[model samples]
Target chain A: MTGFDFPPPVMPPGVEALRAEVRAFLAQSQAEEGWRPDSDFGSDWSASFSRALGARGWIGMTWPAAYGGHERSALERYVVIEELLAAGAPVYAHWVADRQSGPLLLRFGSEAQRRAILPRIAAGGCYFAIGMSEPDSGSDLASVRTRAVRSGDGWRIDGTKVWTSNAHRSHYMIALCRTGPAGESRHEGLSQFLIDLEGDGVEVNPIVNLAGKHDFNECVFDGVTIPADRLIGREGDGWRQVTGELALERSGPERILSTFHLLAALVEAAGPAPEPRLAEAIGRLVAEFYALRAMSLAVAGRLEAGALPDVEAAIVKDMGTRFEAEVAETLRRAVPLEPVAGDRDGAGGNAPSLASALGASVLGLPSFTLRGGTNEILRSIIARGLGVR
Target chain B: MSDETLRLIEQTADDLFAAESGAARAALAKGEWPEGAWQAFAATGLAQAALPEDAGGAGLAAGLAVLRAAGRHAAPLPVAETMMATLLCHAAGMEAPPGPLALSTTAAGEDGDGSTVRRVPWARFASAVAVVGPEGTLTLRTPADVVEGANLAGEPRDDMALSGPPAAAGTLPPDTDGTLLMALARAAQLRGAMEQALAMTVRYASEREQFGRPLARFQAIQHHLAEIAGEAAASGAAVDAAAEARTPFAFAAAKARASQAAGTIARLAHQVHGAIGYTAEHDLHHWTKRLWAWRDECGNEAHWWRVLGTDAGQGGGAALWPMLVAAGTAGTDAAAAAGEGARP
Candidate 1:
């Protein structure tokens, strides 16, 4: 019988030192800056904080040194990112570029594009937003109506991408567009281009989320022109390039630790010696977390060894996202506190931080399973992996 | 052991059990010990695989791999219990008794009424039972009588009434937690059981038809099978990680995860199989029933959850992170030692 293989990860050497470095940096940043720790990665964006991580050589860690990377292993990068995520650090500015765009460029971008954009990304001076989702397309990405036609020495893109997080703040967008006939398969004739978000005929309109945040944007491209070299990989190979990185996209600390601050807060509220029942609740979540981490690490280890392990990665995301959502619901019952709108001060005469963290998590819960492909989509991917569909 | 050797050992054990599947089940139905199967397995020396080289055994990795295969086949004998007994005896500086064995932890009260040690797997068939106390004291006993009991899988779980003093007793090695070891054993078995259940369900779903297409072609059915696959994978990874780590916390997490997966995997497996899987005639029950029984064996999800939660909550919230980070490397030395201990 066929089965998923998650061999034990061979951890990179000297990770303890690297873990120490990340922890110390987070502690110093929290103490000195006193930034309100975001409960999740996408909730907050701080350019300076991104720059701080970049200056420490933590971004683009696994890429070549020629592109401002540290030439570190993926496991090392995993250590840094997990540490940052667990602390709820403001990693949004460089998150997309560091996580997906930079790696994509390293894999499929031209040398000129790499030399130009990768260094900026590693330095945390530049950021990117995904332009795959459009007004007519979310999970059915192949149905995107965005069109990029060949113009003299360049390409002209015209389309609107919805749910484009941070499109306003990002420097560039990797837009997937139909460059040729649909042919027999809809996935055919699609291409990805590096469109400058600030170029002419581009518009960014804010779409407020349930949390009263402007993280989501609707980006409109009215014939925006990009250089011919901006095409990522080969034209019409967009589907493979995008689908190839699901393992990298889905199986990360971000997927699991999105609501970790809530769990941490619950632990804090439980105090030094919680009741057995409350401890059990906490322990239940921790046990799930422990197992999920091992699975995630196994996938990461496989990725570092150049194996996709996409099925295993999908399992991690499906379970990890559900676990993330479960944390909030469990904490609501486990911790007897009505979530308050975060006041950002102690004037409320209550455990404001716990209540506020709980509040943020509850509000952010919907996106846990929605963003980065909904749980249904992930389950389908897992089923395909099982060869049952 | 190298990956190649481990694969070879597991393959050998799998072949042996596959060949014995019919006889093992026949013995269970007849209410008699499968003496032939027992002798055939014992001749392999794989039972002592976890003992040190000086003790003439393979290693912990080999031993756990063998347990996994035993779980896959739901081997009727007390293979895991015997392995634990052998390891306990070797740890206590004593040679294990020959024949099928079970490890028991309970002792008769001072009242001396000969009240039985309840639910010890294959206890009636065991030539000797190694009882290890919480403080690492090992007492090897030959039971005076046995009352037959069975788990949901119809595997022997007899009650042994101790009458006289132990035949042999000694102190186990320091810091050895018997319950944790048993939990690890059960978790490994659960991993194997869940995997087998998933494989069976996937095959059934692929072959069975409804609405003019295979059941696997249905989205709803596919999702159910997918969830089962996730649980199985998580359980397997958890057991492997716990074995490699060998810490009490790691073992607790493994057992909790496995026990947690058993319910969902069993339910989904049966659901995908429809009426056929629920019947006693089908082989799927061999795995599902064992999953239901094995989950509550060492400790259920609630029991281990408390242990993990309490350990996680020490020294307030800030201390939890360090403890978790430390847990990643908690028992690496023990695991590495167990691996190298059996090497020449």
Candidate 2:
């Protein structure tokens, strides 16, 4: 069979102008506010930084004007995100809300929910955390044990969510909970609840990562009251909604850009000309990265057209994560020492610039293939798409 | 080469292939040349699809339509090898073989003889063999004793013992082109096998349920399938680009990419399939086994990687950017040419 045509990722006409505007804005922000890039190992939630970005209409650029968005195409947003991530901007505050939750709510939430949350998300005043993974239901989301029982005109939720990234800092968490007993199909009987983290009955405890960072949390809900209207989409449709949301979460520049900092460090360390092995490794890595980026963009194009590129998205994530892992490995091999103190501040230290970053990346790499949906899961989907199985 | 021509060729092959039924598979099982199936393909001029118009061939260009039929059906004949042989002949200004010829090659140092042409592992099934000697001379040799055999698909890989002067000799340029062609062909076959294996695993996952849900619903299975799919896609694109490649460096890159993808995809397929896939009773073995053989048969991953690595070194430290630019242009040109060739 012939190979599908995958054109290289280039800015659409006028995209260069958009890039210039963003770069100017970022440059000014960097100079005026002393904006240091976010730490590679920690979960960052900088409200002021996100607010500045949102004020510039960069948070939800692809959404409609009514929702405080600029009505840009996904490709434009892609370029914007790439620049943001490449610059290591402190975007974690609005990352989930803008990257996925806002889009999800826009698509599946009730009109009231959208009207209430969309603007705040666009304004970057609000943040969201995914409460899908429970202690027992990280990958098998359908096995979520969180329960939400009807209480008068609202629901009382009681369960614990593990690995809730930035839950302590998020304004709201969209939790996938069982509204009823497990149905014949595991995916049935599940519903999503939008819980306010500041509410009285919710407790967010730190789940320190391997880097000893409080980026993730174990969020316990003890009879947390939520209005019935807070449910996303129809009750018992959590699986479909979550699956759609994952299409947003898993297929993006983030999967590949996790190693962008390391790449930059490598370029700096190697100078104009690198060692033979390092050069070859970097070359292969860059080629694969380019290919993976193309695939991700292709999926984005398909997603924008309202198509369910489930298999295609899976393929992108699998390849993207593998490439990131490879980059991490290559960097580790090329430079063996640790990044000395003040390396981030450019003190001309002998420390390995990527040492701390590599530590975090290595710990995080396993989850790249395991989290969202494991690599194996995506492969099966691809296999089915090919009609071999 | 027009779209209409490509469509016509594919349609014709599809029809003839449909009519031929299980003859190829049967021949494969019997370790004999699928002569009947070959005749059916010859009648449709598939053997000469890539040959020039003057060579009594269909003059189809190198592309998907020409390769798809062979891949989809797992045709038991050496259609690709023979096409490469025909191209070599044409390039050497020699007449292409008329009918029922099998083309094969031996690695530079692998054969038993120090100077004489030696038998390759898969050379047994050919009626005639094209041997390219170390001096860059190409020879068409007919062996004395022919023994029927099969490769991964049970397709015939007849054995022939060669012991005579090389016939119909012509010289190929002492460059990487011949080796590149071999690598490309092997990569193409690996791509085909990967596609089939992926299809098999996915279908199995959907239909095969455990714990009351389809295997596909499991995250582990999905991840496995995704890896396989990604690798297969990468391999397909790489090999297709390699086939149309002009430069040795471009060929090296494509070969490296394809070989890595093939090995990874095959292993993932087997892992997803589990016990049944490991057994000879299941058809999954057919694809996986072939993948293993094909990956190592031509220049293996290490060999090609070194070639690419050495090439990069020679071009200096900043060689990567230029090499990538060159590869991209070459890939685009080949794609455009293939597209043009498929036009009516």
Candidate 3:
């Protein structure tokens, strides 16, 4: 009824303190370790970088204490993630685990699975790769042919998952597989299994991205055995589980901050006195950025109150991703200087900031729109929410 | 005006328009003026919503509220134009048009026959056309419909063939006020069209698919669609800021932003709709066509930008920041003023 009058995103009383702690930790880490912040590494996967964050009890901050979590609010976790992303800290190592896997296990995983996996996630020692997209199953996730036949005490998984980000480095993966025959509903007969990447019969083959980096992999799960308890939630509920996971995945600061580093770089390159056009563009961008941040916080607030905020989340993601892409473009057109030796190579090499960010951003941009759900899907949700449809 | 009064005005207009115009369908089909609809709106005190309270109208700042409802339903009646005319008349200390009158305006021009006025569009549908002459005098005339060309909305244009006893005309100084008001009205129409286009595309995307997943699942599609959302939101904010400013410059910026956004959005909507969007059978074209016409109607993007650019240049380069701050802070009330100093 008013200006974003929803519940405040659930956060502990000390969440601001937690943010201050993370900021101090990052500042110290940058000073001591002399880490070179790379825009190309949108999310860092450095083992050392992750363990340092874990040491401060920042990783898996929202899970129960018994599972090595600090048992904080989701908003507190959101604050930490926002700070980490803004600082461009290398956080890819435990990102998936902290973001969704740890929470997923706590919710639907068996006791043995939670006990075995979550503590490592909180300690930042474990990593997880999503095994949803296959070679032929890019957007058509329901058509995945990856199958797991029931064995004596476990299931034998034999299929290849393509575009599996960080599969080579991840300790384990939660793969969606067909455990039953194809039925009337394509969404039916699907189940998710937590497979150990280091286990026997599992192969992690590198798939080089367009940037010539091994950020993704083609994992072959040939006769990979997972114990009966490895299945997440009830059988045939994979669709519902994945949908819930997306609500978490899509409704975060990540959606808007993808091009944040580029913005910083552009500002730095522009110097204190910007050209009139450039200044105006930056000012407009900043206004939209603030509005989006408020919108995202509102969604986070909704989710913290045990509400889905599905349509609102979609709106945030939609607006956020566009702003990200636009920032990259705006910087490309505004700045005239090239990166001096150490900067990453982007497309065309003319505008490296745009190129480097755009290279990852363009490839990654598709997923931003399509990943959690397409913009079109989100709009439909918004339309329904507004009662216009 | 208070929120309750605004709500009441919106509800009354929405109800009367729905009943008299039958949700814009009858107007869209017959191209006949909804005289009854106009009378109902006048009865509800919306015909002069922006006039002074002493005038025979509600005298409330109901611009945004009225625009939102009109945009939602794509109502074709000239509510915004009528309100603008009423405001201008009140500002000039002239008696406002009364009893279901459609008011139109045009820029000043020279004509030996005392007929041609510069830059007048949609002059045929007006009961009376107002023209600002070369001497800066505003002249009102009731003219024949031959001068107004065919309008996209199917309504008769308001172009007037002027030939009458020269009536005394009011004068407005060289400022952006009149142009700004016209631009705001057009921007409101564009805003409505943008919302409709977004809704149409989203529906199409959900029901249609190419590679198993809904077309909405493709990242490329989502990215384009997301851009549309961003544009719409930005334009909405800009329009609101302009309306709240009640100044020529702010409204000029809003008009420029809204016009550009509407054009881009319309093109993208058609792109997302693909071949189906181009067809007449689909109602998507109705909104898209209106967007194209509206963007170029009151003032095109190029014209407004040139005006804004000239104004900024003339005001000196340093004035840009303060102007921007003023524009951003235009819409906030007193309670929201704490952070006002922190804006730019």
Candidate 4:
């Protein structure tokens, strides 16, 4: 069988120094800002923290310097993002932008769009929300019903985007709207637009999650007008562009490290000398973590080498997300503590105690495998890659 | 050796192993040494691949790559055991002996010269056995009263009674970890075997029809194949990481992950193949059975899991991430090589 080539990752020079710098910055920021450590990126967002990180050139990494990027290696970007996630840093403000949107823009956005928006993203002053999913479209993203009609000199967007994370907070959304008919394939005749979230006839209603938090929103677009130049790529190339960025969105350390905080807390609770069974569980999880990280890093290395390893990226997400949920369950069964939702305030009052971290993780576990793409869809992608479909 | 040369050697090894597949199956069935296959492998001088560069051998990475290809075919021989034995022999300044080599990790008990060592892989076929321990390395040319044993795959794993002075004796290198190396070898083999199984299962699903359609068309079956593919990919990545890093932590992680994947991959592969996969006539057993045997040979998931857990525990919670990063990136290049293709 011809296996996917995931060559071992090579760390760039000065990576360790960069890692140290990020760590020192994070430690100091956490101390000074007094922000509570969240379970994952979605649990927290701070504009100041994102701006501070961007000022250090962590965001917009691996992009061309002409587009306000630091021109760092993908591996360097990997290390910085990995550190942020592992420390439970408040990175949601710039997460989508740094991960996929900026790269998408650099690759497909118009010149004026790049010059005007990319620098603001690099400075972490601008945030982006994805507008691919709808009330009818979840896994079958090609079945999106959102339509963009040609009106005046611009386009009028008239559809609703559901489960849009932070649409209320994000400045712009690259919405995949139907610009033409589905001739032979549904993936055809689709286009992406850089719709301003604050434009006329735009409404973002919060959808409280299971944990009683408002990270997601249902955005309604009623004839929202956008400039003609706001199109991300070619009019009919939206499907290709969106699929192109899946490798970037699916293969990062975020998929697996969502429960990292819980693991660290479990280790702390287990103490220096845990029981044999407890140690075994923890060790098994840790080993899986290491292997999954290696796989993700390998994919990042491949992407850095200019190969779009979609199948490999899907495998990473499939295994990594399962590992994430397994971590939560393993902790719940192995640790002898009841999960309790701690105080709502920041770390100044009550830090994320072990119970609270576990609580947050349990509540957030369902979305781990469901978000980005469902585990079923990911497995289907892998199966297709294996030529089974 | 340069990567180009290593790739060529790997290709040659893959072809040789593919050609020897029949001999491997026959040898296992008859419980005899695959003399033709062994001779063919020896002619390639792959045993010396893991030796020091000054010793006219390629580096560890090349050696692991060769072993990985060998494991890919499930060649019924002691390729890993022999390669590692030769490494120890050369490091100890002993001229490497001919024929297949068996490896043992158990130290000589209170009886010393007359001690009994168990679970020696391919002991009956071995021309010489290398017994490595904390004390040093010892080579036994002959053993008295060999009790024949076989793993699930029907490869020899005999018990031997040693009753004489060693043919060669020398101190091991400071970094020589016999168990870790053996585990790494098995991990590589597991990676190869899983890939083969995945390929076989994928092919079977695509070709075999059920209810007037290929089994692969069914979402349930496709998902099974997908899980197998996922595990195989993870196992390969883990093996590659460990081979590049060569650290205790890396090896432990690799073996544990591979061993863990071994169970799921074997189960899913068998499930997807249906009854045909379980029968002895089908070649799928050649890979699946070995996956079972290899997972427990050097160290299983549970064994290595404890090693990693204790490591993390001793380091405390704060040190987990750093330790993982160190193990994952150990021995990697300082940067991507210059002149590589850039992303568009």
lDDT of each: 0.81, 0.67, 0.65, 0.82
Which scores higher on lDDT, 3 or 4? 4
Q: Cα RMSD (Å) per model?
A: 2.6, 6.8, 8.7, 4.3
Over B176-243, each residue of candidate 4 has an lDDT whose tens digit, in order, gives 56667777777888988988998999899999998999999999998998888888888888878876
lDDT by residue (tens digit), candidate 1, A183-247:
78778899888888776557999999988888899988888887888899999998888877555
Superior by DockQ: candidate 1 or candidate 4: 1
Model 3 alpha-carbon drift over 4 Å, by segment = A1-41, A47-80, A115-125, A199-201, A267-326, A336-389, B1-16, B20-39, B42-66, B76-189, B197-258, B268-286, B293-344
For candidate 4, give the lDDT of residue A149: 87
Q: Measured against the native two-chain assembly using Cα atoms, what DockQ does each of the candidate structures obtain, in the order listed? A: 0.70, 0.13, 0.05, 0.66
Looking at model 3, residue B104 earns an lDDT score of 43
Instruction: Please give, for residues A1-389, the per-residue lDDT of candidate 2 as tens digits.
Output: 31232323433567757766876786687667665543231234679989998898888889888878889888788767766765566788899999889999999988888889999999989999988888998667888898988899988898999989889888899899999777787888888888888874689899876655677799998888888788889988888998888888877777766766665555455555555566667656654654465566666666666777776777777777778788778778777865433335454322323555666577667766776677766666565565534
Give the runs in model 1 whose Cα sits over 4 Å from its true position. Answer: A344-352, B52-55, B106-115, B330-344
Tens-digit lDDT string for candidate 4 (A1-389): 55565678777889999999999998999889887766477878899999998899989988778878999999899999999999888899999988988899999999999999899999988999999999999999998889998899998889999999999899988899898987787889899999788765579999999898898999998878887998888998889999987777887889889998778777777778888788889989998998888888988898888888888989898988888888888888987777766444232343666667777888888998888899999989989998767
Give interface RMSD (Å), model 2. Answer: 5.3
lDDT of 1 at A112: 94
List native contact recovery per candidate, as a fraction of 1: 0.65, 0.11, 0.01, 0.68
Error of 2 at B101 (Å): 8.2
Candidate number that wins on TM-score, 1 or 3: 1
Candidate 1 per-residue C-alpha lDDT over B129-179 given as tens digits, one digit per residue, 9 for 90 to 100: 877654777788886587888888888777777667889988866645566
Best by lDDT: 4
- Candidate 4: misplaced stretches above 4 Å? A342-350, B106-114, B135-141, B331-344
